[model samples]
Target: MNQDTTMHPRDLLRQMFLAAVEAAQPARGVPPYLPPAPKGRLVVVGAGKASAAMAQAVEKNWPGPLEGLVVTRYGYAVPCAHVEIVEAAHPLPDAAGLAAAERILERVSGLTADDTVLCLISGGGSALLPLPLPGVTLGDKQAVNRALLKSGATISEINCVRRHLSAIKGGRLAAACYPAKVLTLLISDVPGDNPCDIASGPTVADPTTCADALAIVRRYEIELPQSLREILESGRGESIKPEDPRLAACTTRIIATPRMALEAAAEVAAKAGVTPYILGDAIEGEARDVGKVMAGIALHVVQHGQPFATPCVLLSGGETSVTVRGNGRGGRNVEFLLSLGVVLDGAPRIHAMAGDTDGVDGLEEVAGALLAPDTLARAWAKGIKPMDALQNNDGHGFFGALNDAVITGPTLTNVNDFRAIVILDPARD
Candidate 1:
């Protein structure tokens, strides 16, 4: 094996991802924004991949007494002195999440004006706080969540459906603490960083209606339980209103976001002597489709030197969706890379990396995948068909065969996905 100089695109890409993850760490970012202790008791609650870490940070930093609970993905829990951490399912709702949501709602139901509630919101919160509405079962919400995850629904669309069905989401949690001052510090993972969309907006008002949820289910042709279908059709389960007096004392802040992560990555690229082109911080759509489009941009930069010249890196961040029609491992980042490889057709001097900032994409342990100039040729030689793999929603399998999966185990933070394309200039004459 020869060591090629070009900064080993994969290494450079990994550094960029690690940098973004570091920039959004809860221990470093969440503590400072924590509200001062109330005159009375302080209660903490939250949900996301970062919830446990955020809770731990609060526990470590607070000089006053604190007691509360938070839910996080399985295997991501951290120990805290005062707050209880509950591990639950992610990307899909489960019974454990239901229990946690119930507890969260119950915990904040009767708070005094002098007491304070510190709510931590981040990605994966929609599933982590799966409190089904009255007349709905946990099973119903779980089924809907599974379908939404496989339907290529945008984060907002999925969250809209979730908010309608949930008891604690869409400002209901904050609404529970009627007279209490609720202060929410958020780590944004969705595109656009809407407070309501982050973890289904447990602390903020959701202006989206049940009609929008119904439209999403219909667009994706998602089969919902009879009760869920009724809820959507009747438009009965409205989330808390923006002007709801119950939520008047709530204060929400987006402490971190994908845009912030992207800017940090851009700085890294600039330091490497690479002109960085930030396509957008909130690009959304199907993962593979986005990859094909990004490939076109990389080709333009390489051949035409337009938009951005070579020796440049293209950076983008956001949550992309994957419509799973097959049973292969599903990761939006891997799907994007495989699609890009096929589109580029082994174009030399161009490489790309795409991964979830949370360090897990879909159900796979690997965050995403990487593409070198010879990726397509290597797949062809191995009898792997990019189109077939993509059709089966098998980005992980495709990248796994080439040993190109970017595995960063449990990064403990979520800012959605980070994608980068490196277009190197052709060798000088």
Candidate 2:
């Protein structure tokens, strides 16, 4: 569905987010990338928030029989008759994930050249398929993951560490399917849509090494378990290199990405008669900093119209990081909106929305939050200081107080964050 000009600006913003999400749905993105059925048995195995949905899509479209297992974050699973959907913890590994990883490895092992292994990957797979190397336990991996998340390391850095520590990631999963042709269908959730960064490149070859992972851990000052540190220093948990012959037959395809989602949202805005200008789809860095920069861009667009004229919508996608320094609920999207509001200070004739396509921002069930020109004025009316809220990293509380937080439960798919700022012509308003 397209945006409706008659709809409220907030409603239009939400419709744009939903349209972006719909474009990344597994059913919509998977079919065109599906390959010809293999002559031998088809074994499907995957791990991520979207893997279960992707598997279901595969089953619905496949002409032949398929058997497999996929693990997804809790509450993100969809029913699939042939493929078993195992729900597990996300952003962190659990016992279930470890067991599923073992089973998945076993499922693809000993495959013949005639057999085909289909690996459906997406965001969160790194945590959903954590199999630690020998001498390391799941708790150790969990500790590292927790530290990395809180350390404000980019997803690439975080996944680099994960790839080294994981037994299934970093092309090891593809190596296990050694003589078999492994086809990996990915829903890209990382900036630049790098195949190796998505789910830590379980099925694709990894060019990083143990030393690189160690450098990232050191750079972030992430305290790793002594044994884990030893493993890294000793080069024991090194990932499969790009020259590995076992990965020669493996093919990776990105079927969905943040750019695709942003483009879809742009189409909705265009349909509603709003010119959509995509800033960039690979934006990164601190959430608050990005918000401030976006505010400047919006102001420039509204005043000078050099970048674009008013009555236009600015669109961007990509994951932003939040370095939490307070004891408040932290969500990158909400934090971004809050910081943007602080800069706007009730600017005239502008509205914006920021949300994660996965439907959850940070640890909260809220997707993100909305921003109106008078956002700060309304917050002041409620005795809520936007600057203080931003400092506390309490975007959830700030937006919740105004009843402006966007909540969408679990979207069952992830393509990173979506942001849109609509600038209305003051004269028209």
Candidate 3:
């Protein structure tokens, strides 16, 4: 049977996105993985957009006294009683994030073997916890972050560089706890769910070295300050290696992931009578190119029904990079949707939606936008030029003009980007 026969396509898409967000909620993901109460004290420390919420989850579940600190995006804070939540800028590290990172290191320091250090980590932690190594100014960190973000580098690559430069990340935080047992609870937003890549692996051993980080910076031709370059060149920026004894008591567990979020969205599709097909949950690449590839698959399904049958919903989740060109205000999700819209060319019976599950797509507070079959036609009718918008990287502007922008402010949890394509069955309809 055809889905959305009675339900609006946009509404179905929104419901599916919301379900995906709900699946990765810190409140739901944090409790089951909570470690036993320590004999001495339980100290909680975390960093990310969802870290405050994760701290809240810990506070609600822990039966004993606990005090800690976490830093989150400015608008994503969830108030807590014991654990202090600090708000900071994201996608770019601010002075507030620098201070919070310092305090987090101090919070875990001087712990005893009997104590347990509980760490909460998720996406955006790199920016939310920016503790530059000695001699590296916050301005330098901000400058590097700006360069890496615009360089079209993958999250893994960006984080590699971040870890090398950070004093609190790359296993340093866990090392600070020394003899204390450390249990790190992670909500994975990285492509591979590699614990080391999530939040730059503050509580786990790092496999990447300073050379590896330097190579990524060079690969993207990302300009680093001369003094910062010296840190990498001198090997002083090296992360805590896996063989380091300080991390012996560290244990990391992934509590949620992009795959889990996509599966949750798939359930929403299945319940709506639409067959759900999960495209690779770790799909990654340039946003426009990835959108082009997915569009080709969607068209094949619409025309031939070879891989998946009609009335199927294609679901995918992962992070995508954007190489800023013409300077139009847009995020990867919107850019992908815009490219998909262009490639689909208003193909009939196909509708799609793409959004960052965290409710922030790129620099905008808006999540993402929906793509209807008639989206282009609507744009043309309203005197909009799709190609011009694309050239200017103006998906947010284009979608906004069409009144199709998706907005879900501060979702409080992050699992990267979620995209869905709904193919209707004409026969069933």
Candidate 4:
């Protein structure tokens, strides 16, 4: 078949990435999974990059009186009539998140069996709901978060630690609504789409225990404050278990997942007259390492056409990590793209884009970066060494220098990361 060259390679690549993000949007995912209006009272509480939008979706469909509160990352708020939308820091907890967590717990307390709580959950919720347990201060929570993020601990590992030290997560939020039924709506950002892993499973039963959290913290060499360590050692940080009766009235529905987002991007590729191949939606690893593996795959496809043919797109969605050894600003997507660009070494017809679906990659406002055959050549001409950039973990700085950072400020949703490699054509003489 023939390659579709009507749209520029860079634009087509970005279009696919945006298509993935649009698929996991709260407006589209929240409506279908909304629970029916309850009998006694309907309470909504949530935390995430997408929580505000999810809350708005709930308000638009519910036909009864419902008052709620949801905290999202700063600037991610969506207005609602009854449900209060609060904004807070993300990827790290702040006093604002601490206050919001307290309010959410208080809001769900004293509910009878007739009352229903609609828990809106998504990625970023873990940090957005930072209610430290008695002996664990908010400062302790913030310190641990910083160490875990820099240590390159996986989201699941980091959340396991967070849950044990929190008074609200690990089914505690749902427990607070004792006798009241909770219908949780989640837009899963974790690999495997595990409800318990999403937002550290605030309203769901957690089979993991305090020992598990301690193990992860130790394995990652995360420096926890003495208070946090004592909580783990004393078992004071034990999470709500799976057989806990408080969770009997709770249920969850994952409205959107990385796989769904990737599928949507694949559909866009097909419509664009290109074959779309989804490698895996739940891939996990160091960002640069994953990029190198993808580069090997792409090389095989380009040179031998073994796994997939030319003129096709390889699509994937999942969260990759960065172990910060360099002084560069954070963003796993840019790191992955930079590594891919390095490995590809200016190969012909290989173009790719990687970005966080939520529009913020790491601590930076840039989503990610785009890479082309001439990326390295351009960087070298500008006296920027791609190798040095990679070593410094400065993917954002590197791409920014090349004027290639993809910025889609505040897409108001989170479904982890989206990556697409477009092998537009064969090598030319």
Name model 4 segments beyond 4 Å from true.
1-4, 427-429
Q: Per-model C-alpha lDDT, please?
A: 0.87, 0.91, 0.91, 0.90
Tell me the tens digit of each residue's lDDT in model 4 across 1-429: 144247777888888888888888888988888777777999999999999999998888877899989999998997899999999998889999999999999999899999999999999999999999998788888899999998888888888888999999998999899999999999989888988899999999888989999999889888877878899999998888889998898889999899988998898888877789999988889999999999999999889996998788889878889999899876899999999999999998899999999999999999999999999999999999998999899999999999999999888788898999988665321
| Preferred candidate (lDDT higher): 1 or 3 | 3
Q: Tens digits of per-residue lDDT for model 2 on 74-192? A: 99999999999999998778999999999999999889999999999999899999899999999999999989888889999999999988899999999999999999999999999
For residues 1-429, could you state the per-residue lDDT of candidate 3 as single tens digits? 353357776788999999999999988989999998788999999999899999999989989999999999999998899999999999899999999999988888788999999999989999999999999999999999999999999999999999999898999999999999999999998898988898888888889988999999999999988989999989998999989999889998899899999999989888888889988888889999999998999999888986988888899988899999988997999999999999999998889999999999999999999999999999999999998898788999999999999998999898999999998887633
**Cα TM-score per model:** 0.96, 0.97, 0.98, 0.98
Compared with the true structure, model 1 gives a TM-score of 0.96
User: Clashing residue pairs in candidate 3, if any?
Assistant: none
lDDT of 1 at 111: 89
Candidate 1 lDDT trough over 10 residues, lowest sum: 1-10
Q: Candidate 2: what lDDT?
A: 0.91
Candidate 2 residue runs with Cα over 4 Å from true position: 1-5
Clash total of candidate 2 = 0
In model 1, state the lDDT of residue 16. Answer: 80
**Candidate 3 weakest lDDT stretch, 10 residues:** 1-10
- Candidate 1 residue pairs that clash: none
